[model samples]
Target: MEKFSFDGPPVGDDADISAECQRQLLSPIQEIVKAAVAAGWSRQDVLLAMVELSWDMYEKRRGDL
Candidate 1:
């Protein structure tokens, strides 16, 4: 995985932040899907798991705010 530093000025606007967040989020999901596939999970199973995980995270973060 590549390391990203944001120690300087803002990368751009809200769109840029959203894009970066998405890229960072999907990077881990891609890895999880690959590992799950290798471990005998179907593509649909992996996708369902991803959806559930995303919703769980969203709910948790929403509560934190």
Candidate 2:
């Protein structure tokens, strides 16, 4: 992943911007969990898979760390 920094003017108050960022970040995970559940996956299994995937991605992104 590429590093990103906001160099432009502020879009909103910090609290509002942070809240929106949290919502945006979680939206995809919520959808993924919903789909997994709908497809008959247990919540535990889905959560474990999510954790594993997150760690794997983190390792990949932080190569040689």
The regions of model 1 sitting more than 4 angstroms off are 1-10
Candidate 1 worst ten-residue window by lDDT: 5-14
Residue-level lDDT of model 1, residues 1-65, one tens digit each, is 65654433336454476666676667667877888999999989999987899899999899789
Q: Which residue runs does candidate 2 get wrong by more than 4 Å?
A: 1-21
Q: CA lDDT of 4 in candidate 1? A: 51
- Clashing residue pairs for model 2: none
Model 2 lDDT per residue over 1-65, tens place: 33434333337445466556656657667877888899999988998998999899998989767
Alpha-carbon lDDT, every model: 0.76, 0.74
Query: Clashes in each model (backbone N, CA, C under 3 Å)?
Result: 0, 0
